[model samples]
Target chain A: MSATLDDLDRRLLWALQDDLPLRERPFAVLAARLGVNEDEVLQRLRRYLAEGIVTRFGPFFQVERMGGAFCLAAMAVPEERFEEVAATVGAFPQVAHNYRREHALNMWFVLAATRPEGIAEVAWAIEDAVSLRVWLFPKEREYFVRLRLRP
Target chain B: MNGEALFVPDERDRALMLATQAGLPLEARPYHALAERLGWAPEEVFARLARLRAAGVIRRIAAAPNHYALGYVANGMSVWDVEDERVDEIGRWLAEQGEVSHCYRRPRALPLWRYNLFAMFHARERSEVERAVAAAAVRLAARFPGAVRAHEVLFSSRILKKTGVRLDF
Candidate 1:
């Protein structure tokens, strides 16, 4: 869906995405910088959330730094077993996000654990429980990309 | 899903989520630092994060230090065409690996874009990604003989923008 962004709204978004400043009264600081009131800052934020401009507005952890292992996985699921397999996969604590794709390998999701070895364990668990062949596609390197929305 | 309902974040939880998404202080006491800045109690800050976690809004609050700067330079998006009967299990298994961080199953394109399962892999060098892909291919071929009809790998050239979270206030 298209996002309707005004000057003020864009300002707020730009500031927040860059990283809130470190200081007492950050809202006030932001407001002053944007030439608006703290309440206005809060109100606009509320509107933004209500408008669904943001899918998630919370802290995201660095799995590796946090002593955890995370990876993205996909499987080709039969039509009849879609829901059952999705539920099973989602039940795992490591499975963070699950999606239904239109392909032979329709099921996809993420998995994370405290240890690197846990990767294989979780994968095996799902394979055994689901009774399907599983593939382990791990990241060999890292590339950080921050997607920004233009105002 | 309706676009309106899909993007809306609850008002009560906006402040905390916004703070984290915007970015957190790289300090010993990050939570405390945020509390001091927001003029709220440290416990309050932690409490909000906990609530967000429980609510499935904030999945995890942590850092994604500069990957490229740190030397993990190789990365690629791999797509596979696995049999529908085994894709679900295979996807879950793949996600359980540490190397694959981003996984998705998009609607398959016709003859040209037959690979439906997409997974992101990061390595210190392009060779690492190739090795991983080859290994994964071998595993798949052994596990599901004659199952995967095709596969493709696309490396990321230049990262444009990747942050998706938006906090309006």
Candidate 2:
């Protein structure tokens, strides 16, 4: 989490969390909306990016809509070689997210791909590359997937 | 068949998808900017975007918030082992909750793991997440009269790698 944010910082974050304006000067427009100077808003955002407060600051796309695919898969990797397996799995451009969880199948990852075949191709590559059968658990339905962490 | 097979995006749509996926150039008249770069009229780009959106190709034209910056420090991956037939009904109900950010039905790894439904809840404290999970359990109980078999919340130990999308796939 970001270190103590002031009132103005919070306001800027809350306001920018929505779709940014599609204009010549978005930050300027946003600053106007937030009642702050354009340079200050841009500087704050730059600082946030540098500080890792903001992982990404831009338009977000729904990859699935573009015929891209994603899935959550897990592996019961050997404790000794967990790091090795995780590194192998994480190397793929298709694997957008990889996490170490607490369970029998402790290693979990989300495979993001541009093509349908790309998903299985990457999954198979990982299976042979790491000597572990990757259990593919593709999403059957997405009930909801919107997140807004209020400041 | 998947949406890809059902709706084949043309060369122009592909260009639009690639452009939009990269985070619309942070500028005013982003659509116009996109058009200028794509060598099409602004209206053409706007119309294409609208069509893509309507087709569920672009779920939304919106901002992706940085949760950590906003104080949602704790992340919980709550999984449930509910009756297979009743999974969707309960999953949708739980997804409607304020706490759940994402909910889905995935194939359960049997015998060893039985959880078939997954919902990720984020908050400042683990207790807050537990309360949300408890409420979900209650929702399951209400709908099917105590049919939820088991559930667990797997808080991520570490985020090895996370980037929401890979457009260059």
Candidate 3:
């Protein structure tokens, strides 16, 4: 997958992770820093977004800061019933990211809602839909860490 | 963090969020494009965005690359059962490690689940992730000894869904 990316593309990917300049021509500023033309930068970014190389490309909002809540929930489903449960859980708009992990508690997902109470409400609704106990693990404290993946 | 009042997005803010949640327009003047779409002045759009950022509602205007597409195929959620008293200290320590992307102190479900400290590790290969976690475990044991108990790494087998936070206004 990475073989399709060139040196410029890799650098652009790394650079895009940082905050973009809030100027009239943000792409121009980025292009300058990357030693590329504005058109080239925009073209590559469009391609990246279209190709699924970049999942999202805009403001990263912290729901907590906005008085929203995010909770990590998990459930252990029978192997035969895993797909059904996953589909049911994934149907909820509050489910931001759901993953099938290798553990007794296999179905893990992150729930986000506008209000703190809303998280539990969604979890309960999912529980009702799936007939499985949803264990919510709200973070008591978050340790800060910056992640930058080198391409 | 919960003590602070929530920053409720007004109608305009909600409209702006809905418009830009997918992404900023790839144009010479993205904000202007947004303003035109929302039928607001460009300056108003800029001011609102700046205010939202200052209020911490918007973490940053950035790009989130797909880790798997970037060749980071191995992603592991490392959970540990550390002493309650030292969990914070250990979590802070783990957060400083390059391999640890996110570290948090969460409640442990007794009996079945005993992990309170969670840290995510990502690498190009599963073996590399395992080795990194092993090295971190050894170091953690050396530093905290008895405080560190059982640990497990749950590798993600599949992404059932991954649409980041979509709030219906």
Candidate 4:
């Protein structure tokens, strides 16, 4: 992932991340506000997506509200089998965000599914398949979730 | 699902949701683009989106920023072991703090991981995160007394897998 970014890229990012206007030509509105042509804004956004600078560029749903399940799961894989285990567990479509963390339980990932009940079952299956104990930590309650960074 | 679930989506609602899960096209009429792609009328798509937002099914239709790229490199997941009885109350208070981007109540993995309460604090520097964690600890200690036990902040080393929540329906 490239760390270097320019001023316009930064502004575009901050602008898009904000609640965009709910309208027919939202990007055009964004361009109008950013003082750039709609095409330039669109091209850069599409480029960001193509280059993986922005993994996603769209609506964020409250899946839980839609009866979906999301959980944070982890497993302590022996150093030798870490990659294999990661690939194995990550193959599951339910797995969304996975990370390597600095802890005894190092390989962490988020499991999500439209059918909320399926998350636990899939967690169990992942554990069984990997032959490593999986620690499934489903959030009983979320205190806060608002996240934003000033670029 | 809770017995008192806020909203129960219909087939059409699900279709609209699944279609726009990745995102709406960056166009003047984003909903128009969505409708064109999904073979539905723009009015119907727009109306459904409005209803979903009102119902809280759609949290927000906005840009998802890559924080690390913006130089906020340090992401700390702080886990706390708080007394079960007063957890909900403590969680509510912690969630209000500005530094805490995300916080949750998770079950304890006793003998291994005893911490149940988890809050993620992010910053550009590890020392900054640690300082904030320390301050948060002091604040929590003063507020909750003996109910709040030990805590640990686990920093992420790498992005093994990160993507939009992929739904297979």
Candidate 5:
């Protein structure tokens, strides 16, 4: 679906990237800042979400801060079995983000688990189910970079 | 940093997390709405959220726009096989670039994968992303000659699944 954003929508999208206030009427604060009413802000956000312009709207939790683990993994699935392997791999709840990349290691995914050990367990189970070796590339160090898309 | 010692959410906090995992209610008083849902006072809910934020458990309460819908269709994972001694410095430098969204140093699986540094770049056009990657490589080469052995930009063809880290309650 084509997203034709208006001026207000564009401003709202950009504004929403930052942290919303922790107040009783956070949206009201945002609306006042944007020179719009709270009802308009709510309506626009609802429409954006319904139209899939905004994938999610809420608090972003840091799993690592909560003692969780996240690991990046890759596997090379045969061209013929790519779809099947993807289905099997994506079936796991721990597989947070899976993508088909152009490389020998075609299937790349991220596994997130509550505990550090759960990461390996999920990888092993996925390997057993798909009958393919899963290469785990856990981050040794992370360089900070905030993601902010211009609306 | 020990996350458990930093902030271990008790049963109530877990309930709060479960309630807002999908998202906060789109209301004038979202915290109050959450308070009503969990049968807790608004003040207590706000206090817990503030504590979580302070503890770094919650990064931010914000909106995640759909990149594709926003015209950021080209997503490139730029991997560089840099010298071990300079990877961290180079990774930090790459992280500073505006084009880079995420940068990390990961273990290299020899004989198969040689790249240890990964940086993600997204743009509206594939050529734009490629240009940025090329520019970055040129800058890296100029700054640190012979530090990078090889590099490749792996563009994602499709998103098979994308549910951001849904932890079971």
Candidate 6:
């Protein structure tokens, strides 16, 4: 959750969230549309990124058709082992996000394996390393997973 | 396989995608319609989208095809007690099924949680989904002994909201 953004910030965010200028000097293009100078556009974006309000201002791909596999997994790690488990699991290139929830299943993350089997290997490796049972909760149906950020 | 980074769309392209995803107005010349709202050329809008597809930002800009809108309604998350050696093999089989949309191997619970392999299936009703899962389980079990352990069919109760990424630039 985030606070409401100012009008100018909202408009700028709407543009970036939906689309970003693909040119080398994308800021210049965005500035022209905003009726602001390129420097101002760049500075605002830098500030936003620094603030963590914009976790990632980049592109994301739909991997299924491209022959990639991804899934979300959670594990009930003891509070004492949270740091150790997270560090070990987070090291994998396939692991996208890892977070601690407030339930018996506290640790969760999304892993994208280049190959389908790679997912199993990663899961097994983590289980062995952590000496904990990992519950694989792959999305049965992606009814909805999108997040709406209205600045 | 490694591919070039997904293309980030320009403003016009973004507008088109957002408009479409947010629920397109059932009006003629939808592209032109949105173009007017954005004060841009419709051709410019189409061209930007074409560039986006070429760049791989969009997998496809087609209709909702199979699940949400169409007839198949019941959705359930299927979990399996697959061995570390056989989970990948089982996941691939699930991926090939028409009813299966999402498939992956997640970490299992340390001692009691033996189910690590999971897949999602959708159908018209709860019965339809149950039948599909029964068939899938049989296929999975035939390949690996004691493959199926606990499969929970949690039906979706409500939809809070569904939208894409938040951009606050």
Candidate 6 per-residue C-alpha lDDT over A1-151 given as tens digits, one digit per residue, 9 for 90 to 100: 2434578776666555555443435556777898887777656665565554454443454544334566676788887887777788777666766655444666766766645676788888889989997666654433222222334
- The top-ranked prediction according to DockQ is 3
Question: Which of 3 and 6 is ahead in lDDT?
Answer: 3
lDDT per residue for candidate 5 within A8-89, as digits (tens), equals 9889999998999999899999999999999999999999888888877888888787778889999999999999999999
Scanning candidate 6 chain B in windows of ten residues, the lowest lDDT window is B160-169
**Could you tell me how far off, in angstroms, the CA of residue A141 lies in candidate 1 after the best superposition?**
23
Q: Write the per-residue lDDT of candidate 1 for residues A67-110, one digit (tens) a residue.
A: 34666566777879877887787767667656554445566566
Question: What is the model-wide C-alpha lDDT for candidate 5?
Answer: 0.91
Instruction: State which candidate, 4 or 6, has the greater TM-score.
Output: 4
Candidate 5, CAPRI quality class derived from DockQ: medium
**What is the C-alpha lDDT profile of model 4 across B62-134, one tens digit per residue?**
7666667667778899889999999988888877777788889999998999998989888888888899989
**Residue B159, candidate 6: how far off, in angstroms?**
24
List where candidate 4 sits over 4 angstroms from the true fold: B1-6
Model 6: chain B TM-score relative to the native chain B: 0.73
CA deviation > 4 Å runs, candidate 2: A21-29, B1-6, B27-47
TM-score: the better of candidates 5 and 6: 5
Candidate 3 CAPRI category: medium
Per-residue lDDT of model 6, residues B1-169, tens digit only: 2346534455555566555543332233445665687787777766765565676655443222213333344666666776667667777877777777666566665575566766767776779877888888777778766855656554543221222222211
* Local distance difference test values of all predictions, in order: 0.61, 0.76, 0.90, 0.83, 0.91, 0.58
Models 1 onward score TM values of: 0.49, 0.86, 0.97, 0.93, 0.96, 0.48
**Candidate 4 local lDDT, residue A10:** 82
Candidate 2 matches the true fold with a TM-score of 0.86
A-chain TM-score of every model: 0.78, 0.90, 0.95, 0.93, 0.92, 0.83
Report the candidate with higher DockQ, 1 versus 6: 1
List the candidates ranked by lDDT, beginning with the highest. 5, 3, 4, 2, 1, 6
Q: Poorest 10 consecutive residues of model 3 chain B by lDDT?
A: B1-10
Compare candidates 1 and 2 on lDDT and give the better one. 2
Candidate 3 structure quality by residue, lDDT tens digits, B33-128 = 999999999998999999888878898999888888898889999999999999989999999989888899999999889999999999998898
